[model samples]
Target: MAWGITKKITSAVKKSAKGKATTASASALMAQREEARRTLLKAKGTWSQYDGHLVRGRQFLADVVEQKKTAHTDGTHTQADGELVDIDAYSHAFDDTPNRYSASVLELFLVQKGLMENSQGETYRGPYHFNSATAVVTGNPAQSAAVQDMMEVLKNNEGAEGGSRNHASAMTIEDMRKVMAWSYKQCPDELISLIYSRVQSESALDMDNVILAQKHLVIRAFATTGFTIWTRNFELTKIRRKDIVWNCQGCPPYDIPYDLLQDHEYEIYPQQQTPEICMFTHLRAWVNFLEEVLLRRPLEPDEFIFARVGANSVVYASDQLSYDGVMKMLAWMCKEVGLTARYTTHCFRRGGARYRFMFTPLGQRWSLATIRWWGAWAEGESKNHRDALCPIPREGDKSFNGDHILTAPITAAETQELKMSFDHELNCLSGKVEEVLDKLTLAPASSTYSSPLPAPSQPPILVSSPQSLQPTLCHQATISPFLESASTPSMIPSPVPVDSTSSPSPPAFPTTRALPSSSRQHGTTAKKAAPIPGVGIPDLPRGPEAWRTAVKQWEDPAASIGGKALKDWPEEWYTGPMRTITGVKRNIRKVIAMEFYRLQRDEAIFVEAYPEATCGVKPLFDAVQRQREGRSEITRRATYITLSRPAVAGTTFPGPTRALAQLYLFIRRHSVLVH
Candidate 1:
């Protein structure tokens, strides 16, 4: 029996030794693998580890490397050339380092202050928080003993808290709330209950709460709703309240609520009742009112978050204040209490606009069904389903039709007149009255067909003087000089007449007429005259012989001179893309249509503008071709011009365009003419 027991004990000892050896070997192998992963991560770059495990670190590193390799292979990494890389292996190797923020917290002793609590149910403030023993307390005498003690400590620590120290400012309403909210986690139950009580009472007006609310709205509107408020022209109603409707079947709603609020057209101002204005600007107004009536210490130029009270002024006018004055206020308020990177009011406008689309109903945007139902997407279709749809305002650009100002806060009659004016402006051709009339007669109802019905005609308007219709004629006069200069070279000296009966009086087009005595100096007046045939006045010599003898070859008024009015125009000129068109055919057709129409429009505008030039097509063609080739020279040119142009000056196009147009005409026309 003794011998058998001994044998069993011996066997057990041997097995234990083998198991220990295996465990050591495994641990060593793991350590070596971890080291190797770290090395690889260091090699690949951009590897950072969050969690604290060697294995996890290596895995994260490897993931990063794999991502990097994939990016390289997929042409996403600009620096990487095509190479078969072990993406997974690279990722596993790189994710090993600790986070910088976590390290900063430790270094700054933030966690200690974060965890500290007082018997009065108060907690240690963040880095910005000063103990009664340290701070120089001001403003309210009702501060607690704890706060007093904090101030005392701040006095002793004045060396650390300098006058210019950014973090030394008092806690904002927003920062205090954030700290209290965050404090609840580490706080004892009794302290937490007290904090909640303080919050409930709302007696303590903290900057943190205001900032928190603004941030919450920004997140909700921009990050979640995927829709944003485009225009904030209202003082009373700033909230973007456009919601998407599911089964909405009525006429589209306008943004009139906000518009009216802005214009103060409503009886006694509905900003108080309007929900959109109620959201943002009202808070500012309330704050301003409080500061005036209660606080007595009015807001400074940079103190308020919204444009109310003292905060309302342009940055240039403010002189000393920054453009983002509200942001600075919010930051000062938030950081003092312990929060970071809080938002301001303007953040909502941009943020909301960006994300508003996400919350919109799927078919809210102009689509095939919308086009069919509306006959055309004339900016009103977005309002069709108002309940659940928030339509993003399509802003105006050189390319697309933007928000119609016709829907703004004018009377219905005024709106109608405005609409008529808008239609006339859009419908009219660019030239003399007779030329415009002739063009209108030839123009098709839709540009897609060759011999379509003619566009609607208005009674012939006169071309009296430049200022006859409108006294100033500022808009027209702005472009007149360029046209005049362009036509200079085309000028031909009147043939020296043989007789005196040649020239009639230079067509007595009336001059731009002045307004009545009661009318304001710069005000406009309507004038009427018979339409002249050709725009450019053929400069005739003073003698009657000039007009009679200078080759009066009458041409037919109805002659087709390849003026590119509207024959077989592209379909895209009238409609957006076709919905049912599928696959490559759809893409190709649409691309071709867009390209062709762009080319045609550009060609027509340039050719008509510079008729004397031979290679008029070259500039337009090159510009369009580069666009099609994705070379993007036009954008670069525009961006460059924008960058180079003076900020407080005239239009960008008129300057460079005039120069380039002249250059093109001079080179193409003069060069060919000389040759």
Candidate 2:
């Protein structure tokens, strides 16, 4: 009957899982259909102003030309009128005066100031008045000839020079490399973490590194898709999968505008970034991170794409990020990446165009016509538009050698060499930063604990393993002085010697999330695992009598995980270094839960929220007292055999003719020690 009930529960769980899958699949289908609808709108070329003809009068009146040229008295843009202005206009001024009356006092001022006038020396012949105090544009062009000429000129110039650059500077692969280097710097991890002495470029991070990945994911997507789309910065801000209103501004292309991608929908990083700098990979990663991991739910249509993320993780996706905010970040990236060219949002369009026109391999290069259309340039727009955005580099001396990057495709070997060199530079710089930060955060600690080099007299300090040192009752009596900066000198567990023949220490349980287990130790190819101390847990139930002593550790594993109240710990633990430490005395409870591991030299910190989480030497000896107070030999022997220090004193069960459990335990300990 019990088995049958268990099966029924299992069936219900499976059905629930099936229901969830169905819901997710439906979301995906809805998103796909929404994307299809958007694609149709883009193909039609005026999605924002759909059915706008109906909004204006559908009937063709005698003054149809005037009706079309001028906006409605209610202030609305027509479909054709919206098309006449550049699509980028939606980002800046969605509402504006009718195109016919667009010649404003401000326009006259700018034109008079030499900022807005045509460089070809053409003037607006239409009526306008400019005095020193104020300027006014002509309201009514009663003379039909001047209006027609002005209208024709305006029509010819729409979207012609909107995103064009004067001194065109394309972002080369080297520039992208710098941006990527900057991205790695932003992401604190084994890859570019200050803590690690060496970093591996080729080594991939697990998709499960949710917190670590999210911090960098925002900036990475900004850099990657920012280049790939070649869109305006404001358009880049519209990269929401589920954004409602402006989703159809232009294509990044069209996955995000309707709603976020559903659960299990997007790929993780390193899966696609084989070159260590891939646009598609980072873009997908950023989107996926928002939905599946950071938010832990599909984003609403109104959510921010790059939510307020910090060094830790996403803070919120509440507010719409402004273009000025984005531009400010772009400015920072330009400065930090060491690009001499002051890049605006226009650089993305310009740089991408240059790659298509000149840098791409000859046979695969984009045609001038395709480039024009791809960039939303209108018909009859020629080579000069692309040339202005993506001009060939000319030497100071006007030598043709300046265009060498355009003529020659870099060999794969050269690219790889460059990547490795960047990796080396990243490691050196990040490693130094880690050192400085370690010193900065640990600055409050006394000099004795903050010292870098271990005194020559002391034994080489093993970080976690007290078994490696025979003299300790604790897991580790002291960390190396450099690692000690994270904590004050007092919290270091004072030694309380245990019987040499006593039980082995339990493996340290980390407050921080566990890194992927690695064969590589510190200062190796892989990332260094956070310096977790090998501390013994309070209640292992040394004897059968001790089992029912309200040792509620296994009852709720997480309760003890953060650390039980200081009152709950053995009285002996209240003695020694723990008693002396002011930090431990202040806290009521020990909470070992860490949002993220610290980036410093090798050491585990008894951080805020969990001051006394670090297992001290006195606690180990206190636990041993449980073994000596056995009610019977059966319980006593069991306790001794179960927790016995395996390497030196293997489980003393039936001696030479050992129990299978004892032999297995013996073998396991040997294997651990060997590693």
Candidate 3:
């Protein structure tokens, strides 16, 4: 009976222990699920904030379309009509909405998905869509075709046709020039006031001038640096006059600052800074505009460069101008000028990049490395190594060495010269008009007096003025003393003096004059004359005497082609194969010249050593050509190997040195052939 009672108690104890464990496990599982739910809710809230802005952007676009339709029906939709709506409404909806996220979020979207951001954090904005359809209808026909072509490219849904809804349209040089010309003609005062405000503020305080100034600043920045609208609108701080270089710092990948609170925990990281040199002229303009017009004087290092200019000429210092403001200003300018091409803020960046790549000379071209750095492209390990090795934009460098791909900002000196030229041309035209009027006033009002004055004996000189100085829409010829200063001797041939007895003849068109084969300039030798076109290669030297001459020529610096220094030969001879030669210590040209001389002296010895060269002069020449083609590359590889070797004196030979040693041994083996 005691054993049965003990068995029952044991069973009850086992059940209680099992039930306690089960209850604990259920509670833990429920806690985990609740935590997951909270995390998901947080993420959803963040995304909802972003999605809310996008939805508002879509609604704004719809509203604009409706407004345009209404304007059309009322017959009030004209190009000059800037009063479509108040700027505040658009600004509030797109830029300053409470639901909007930070600028970094917009940048992230752009980088990851190719979705372009406007004042609002949305891809499709009103001005871009509206202007894309309507802007091209009113300008030049050729321009109209170009615009259509670009629009078609943007509109094409096929990936093979180089079209994408995500990609922005690019403007060509001709397109920019046309837009500038049209803008200048339509609103010269406004444009001038805008640029003028950069230097002199008191004269440019008018509301139109302030608005135009803001627009001009954006245009100049785009044309000069290919800055994205986000970078231009949000990233520019109160840049000092001395601060020519800009450094972007923030999150990895895109390098833009993000709000740590809203971002995922994993995404919150330290800032990484990357530096870019600003164009000199553009920097100058920006500094001046910021200090003089914006009145951001004694500029704080972190102060924003752009500000808001409100109605009644009120300037707001607290707020930064939104991407919407820039878009609206540009849209209004296009409409006012009747620009035929569709343009958006992104067009400037795309156009600038395309222009630099296509039109510039090889020496002035931006390498892939430079472009990647400037554009803040996706970084990799290889790119990081290359960036470390490159020596461009060295410290204390103040100017772009010689790059002219970016439209050079009009310097004060250049602007003054243009103005003077225009004045001189104007004076000449005025004088001619006055003379004609005087002649008419003096003549009798009779049929015989109607006869035209005897034509001038000499053909009138047609001076070519700078394009900037020329009158818009009207082409005219003028004679001015300023033309003498403007004309280059190489471009315009001196006029032959006409004899009094000789019949009048038409003026000769200017022809390019060939420079002398050898000349002195500024106490130095001038550049060498180019080889005559269509000329075949000259016969090379032969025998002992020829060998001596070749050696002497190689030793003499003046004998080098184009007077290039011995140290500069590697770069000068750089071809596709020569890129392998990273750092050559000696003169490669001299080495090649010496080899050529040795081969010329003993052909059989060279042929025996290098059997692939075969027999005859053709094969010999071919071998030399091959060596010349690869010499730079070989030298570079050799240098790299030498540098990489462990520090032990005379323990290892560089690749090029080793090759040279082998060649020496071969020549010694065939010494008997030389004698």
Off by over 4 Å in 1: 1-324, 330-347, 360-675
lDDT (10s digit) by residue, model 3, range 272-323: 2111122323434554665665564644544444456576435454566566
lDDT of each: 0.32, 0.42, 0.40
Q: What residue runs in model 2 are displaced by over 4 Å at the alpha carbon? A: 1-169, 186-215, 243-277, 292-294, 307-318, 361-364, 369-373, 378-675
Q: Write the per-residue lDDT of candidate 2 for residues 67-100, one digit (tens) a residue.
A: 5336544334445335433323321221344443
List, in order, the clash count of every candidate structure. Answer: 72, 4, 3
TM-score of 3: 0.29
Candidate 1, which ten residues in sequence have the lowest lDDT sum? Answer: 644-653
Per-residue lDDT of 483-550 in model 1, one digit per residue for the tens?
Answer: 32222122312323355767532211132232123312223423433221111112222232321211
- What does the lDDT read for residue 555 in candidate 2? 34
lDDT of 2 at 116: 36
